[model samples]
Target: MKEKRYIMMVGAVDDQLSQVRASLTETMNQKNVITQWILSRDGIDAIGKVDNQKFDAMIIDAEAPRVLNADFLNGIGRHRNTNDCNIFVMSTQDQEQLHPNLQKYAFLQKPLQTEILLQGLSEALSQNLKPSMVEKFSVDVRVINALIKATMMVCQNYGLDQVDMEKPTPKLLELPWQGQSGAYLDIRSQVFSGGLILSFEKNVFLKIVSEMLGEPFTEIKPEISDAIGEISNIILGNAKSEFTSYGVEMTLPKILSLGQTIDQPAGSVSMLITFGTPMGKFFLEIIAHPRK
Candidate 1:
C-alpha cells in the first residue's frame, strides 16, 4: 500500500483556512488519495509540529504572526524532512523586501478559489524532491472562466446591466495603490504575504454601491464598502468549492478592508481582468503563485 499524503495546516481562525481544508479534503477523497490533516492555531504550535513530524505538505496562513516573519520560515526550511515536504503559505499582507530563498516556496492569497488551490497542490505533488526547488501552481484558467460567467449571471439576475469581460493583462503596480475613499491596495511578491493588491477608482466603486443598494450614490458610505467586501467574499466562497477532486480543504472569511492602504508581501504576481458593465468598467485581479 502507498503511504498516505499528510497535510498540516497552520493559521489563525479565518474563513479562508476553513474553506481551503474542506475543498481539499473533498478533492482528495474524490481522487482516492489517502491523506491526513492537522490544524494549528498559532505559529509556535505549527513550527513545533513541523519540526517533529514528517508531513507531505503544509498549508500555512501567512498572516499568522508566528509564521509571518522570515525567522520562522527559515527555521522550518532548515528542517531535514522539510526538504521533501510542500509548503503552501496563505496571506493578505503585502510582501516587500522578502528574503530571496523564501520566494521559492508556494503562496496563496486570501479569498482563495478551489481550482487555484488544486493547481498548486498538483504542481507540488509532481515535482522532484530537492532542496527549495518548489513547484509553482497556476490558477486553473477554467476556474477563472467560470468566475467571470458567475459574476455576469449574478449581475443580470440582480437586475444590473451585463458586463463585457476581457482577457487578463499582466502587470506589476506600486504597492498600496490608492483607491477611492482613502482605501489602498498593497502588493507583495514573496512567501507568507498577501497575494495581490487591487485599487478601485472611487467613481467606479460608487456605481457598484448604487446598484447593490438600489439607490443613487451621492457619497462614499461605509455600507458601500461592506457590500463590496461581501460580494468578494461570496465570489471566493463559490470559487473555492470548485476543486472537489483533490481532497483539499479551506475556509474563506468575509472580506474586510480598512479604508487605508492594504499592505502585502513581496514576490507576488497580479493579473488584471477587466469587465465592461453597462454602468461602467469593473476589474478583478488574481494574485498568487504556485506551491513549490
Candidate 2:
C-alpha cells in the first residue's frame, strides 16, 4: 500500500499554505495516497513539529519569526528529526535575504505558485516512496522517520538533552519474556495493521516516571506505570494524527507490565530503534504486517 504524505508550511502566508494544501490534496489523491498539510506561524514551533512528525515536504518562509540566525538554520539541517526533511524555503525578498545556511536548499519565491509548489511536493513525495529493506518487512522510510521523530520530540519535551538514536536492527526471533515494562499502541488500516512498542529498562522507566511527575522516588507504583503508559500514549498519539491523515486509525494505547511481551503476527517484520537520553536508554519497536 502507498503510504500517505504530509506537507508542512512554516512561517508562510495563510493564503500561500492554503493554495499549497489544495494542490497537494489534488495531486496526492490522484495517486491514491492521502495527503495532509499543517501550518505554523512561528519557526521554532514549526521546527519542533517537524522534528516530532515526519513530513514529505516542508515549505518554510525566510522571514519567519525566530529563524533569522544562521545557527538556527544550521540546526534544522543537523537535527536527526529533520535531516531527512525535504525543505524548501520561501521568501518574499530576493535571495540575499536568505540565511547562509539555507542557500544550498531549494527555494520558492513568494507569492507562491501553485504549479511550482505542486511540482516540488510531487518530487519530494516520490523520493519518500522508494522502499527500503529492514529484514523481512518492506518498510517505508516515512514510517521509520515518523517513529524516530516522535521519540526525539518526547525526549526534548521532557528536558532530556543529547538524545541519541541507535541504528535500527531487525528482529527475527520472538521477543523474550524478560522483566521489562512498556506500552503499546495498535494501529490498523485496510492495507496494514500492527502495533508500536515503547519498552524501557527498569532504571530508565523509573527515571522517566519520576521526572515526568517532578519528584524523586523510584518504585513502580500503579501511578508510575500509568505515567509510563501516558508517555507511550503521547508518542503514539502524536504519530496517530499523522497516520490518520494517511488513512490509518490507531486505537487506545495499552500498558504492559513487568515481563510482558506482545507477539508479532506471522510474516510481520519487527525492528527495534533505541534512544539514549539523559535519563537512560529505551527502545521503540514497530512490528507490522502488510495486508495484500
Q: Which candidate has the highest lDDT of all?
A: 2
Which candidate achieves the best TM-score against the true structure?
Answer: 2
What TM-score does structure 1 among the candidates reach? 0.43
- Candidate 2 per-residue C-alpha lDDT over 1-292 given as tens digits, one digit per residue, 9 for 90 to 100: 7568777777755765677677767766666677777787766777677667777777778888877655467677777766787887777764447777775566555655444456556656655353431122233334444566677777667656677776556665376422267777776653346777778776677766677888976777765666767887777677665565556767676877665667766777666767777667788777777433
Error of model 1, residue 35, in angstroms: 2.1
Error of 2 at 122 (Å): 18
Worst 10 residues of 1 by lDDT: 184-193
lDDT, model 2, position 82: 69
lDDT of 1 by residue, 146-229 (tens): 355555555555545665665557656343333553222222222212343333455666765677778988677765665655
Whole-model lDDT, model 1: 0.54
Off by over 4 Å in 2: 1-138, 177-179, 189-191
RMSD versus native structure for model 1: 15.5
